[model samples]
Target: MLYQITADGLVLFHLSFILFVLFGGLLVLKWRHLVWWHPPAALWGMAVEFFHLPCPLTDWENHLRHRAGQAGYDGGFIEHYVWPIIYPAGLTPGIQLGLGCVVLLINVLVYLRLWKWRRTD
Candidate 1:
């Protein structure tokens, strides 16, 4: 029971982290100080997707699920939790690279705007 709860918590955390990586630059635009945190996170997020690296959070979630006597899944958090809801097609390397590129592009645009705004100020 405890392990199951922990697994669920990890899934939530993983999803939240992904969201932050995708849009955290916007948050930086508002907070300014968040610039310190968001860029590193965005890079890590992109690296995981672009390089096909395993995310530690997914591993922890699987470990917890196994400890709880649940069957552990084969893939990452997105494959296990997100892919089913959004797309019937399985996740592929091409899709992963595209996601990474999208993340990088969005952050770049946001930061560029922020830089321009700062210069004008």
Candidate 2:
């Protein structure tokens, strides 16, 4: 039971991290100081998706689940959780790459705005 709770907490944290990677730049727009953090996180997020690298968060979550006597899933957190809800067609390599591109595009646009704002200030 404790393991299962831990696994659930990890899943929540993993999801929150993904959200931050995607939109943390918007926070930077407000906080300004967050500029030092969001870009690298966004880049890492894109790299993981583009390279098809395994996320450590997913691995840790799976390990906790297994320790709790639950069967671990075969893919990353998004594939196991978010993809099913958003894209019932299932997750493919192409889709993963596209998602990575989406992340890159979003952060690029956000940072561009940030740059413009800073210059005007």
Candidate 3:
């Protein structure tokens, strides 16, 4: 029971990190020091999607679930959680590419805004 709860908590943290990677640039707009942190996370996030790499968070959660006598899920965090809700179709390379591109586009737009804002100030 404890392991299950911890696994669930990890899932929430993993999801929050994903959201931060996607939108952290906006946060940087408000808090400039976040600029140091967001790039690495955003880059890693994009690399995972673009390169079809597995997220360690998913592996850790699955491990915890198994330890708790629950059936572990296959694939990454997004696959088991976010993808099913957002895309009814099975995940594919094209879909991953699209996801990566979306991340890239969001970061680019946000950073451009930041750049302009800094220039004006």
Candidate 4:
């Protein structure tokens, strides 16, 4: 029972993190503290994609599923839950590199804005 509860919490946190990465900038616009958070979160998101690494959350989910005698997916959560909606097929290295570039570019822009804002003040 304890393990199940912990697994459920992990799943919830994982889902929320996904949402935050996608919509975080919008949230940052309202809460400036969140702006400070954007770069690291963005980096982590891109790293996961670029490296083709399984997120710890996914591992945790799989472990829980296994414990419950449920089947765990072969691919990452993005491949299982998100790929069908966004990506037509399996993810590739080129796509991963592009995703990483996108993350880096966004952080560059954010830092530029932060510098400019600081200079103006």
Q: State the lDDT at 19 in candidate 4.
A: 69
lDDT values, one for every candidate: 0.95, 0.92, 0.95, 0.75
What lDDT would candidate 4 get against the real structure? 0.75
TM-score of candidate 1 versus the correct structure, residues matched by position? 0.97
| True-vs-predicted CA distance for residue 21, candidate 3, Å | 1.1
Between candidates 2 and 4, name the one with more favorable lDDT. Answer: 2
The runs of at least 3 residues in candidate 1 whose Cα sits more than 4 Å from the true structure, single-residue gaps closed, are: none
Query: Model 2: C-alpha RMSD to truth?
Result: 0.9
lDDT of 2 at 18: 94
Per-residue alpha-carbon lDDT of candidate 4 for residues 1-121, written as tens digits (9 for 90 to 100): 6667776777788878876765566566557798778767877888887787778889988898778667778777777777789969887778777866776676666567766766897
C-alpha lDDT of residue 78 in model 4: 71
lDDT, candidate 3, residue 104?
97
Please provide, for model 1 over 29-90, each residue's C-alpha lDDT reduced to its tens digit, 9 standing for 90 to 100.
Answer: 99999999999999999999999999999989989999999999999988889999999999
Question: Could you tell me how far off, in angstroms, the CA of residue 100 lies in candidate 2 after the best superposition?
Answer: 0.6
Of the pair 1 and 3, which is ahead by TM-score?
Answer: 1
* Candidate 2 lDDT by residue in tens digits, 1-121: 9999999999889888899999999999999898888888898899999999999998999999999999999988898999889888878899899999999999989889998988999
The true-structure Cα RMSD of candidate 3 reads 0.9
Give the TM-scores of the predictions, in the order they appear: 0.97, 0.95, 0.96, 0.73
Q: What clash count goes with each model? A: 0, 0, 0, 0
lDDT of 3 by residue, 31-51 (tens): 999999999999999999999
The candidate 1 region of ten consecutive residues with least summed lDDT is 75-84
Clashing pairs for model 1 are: none
lDDT value, residue 22 of candidate 2: 100
- What lDDT would candidate 2 get against the real structure? 0.92
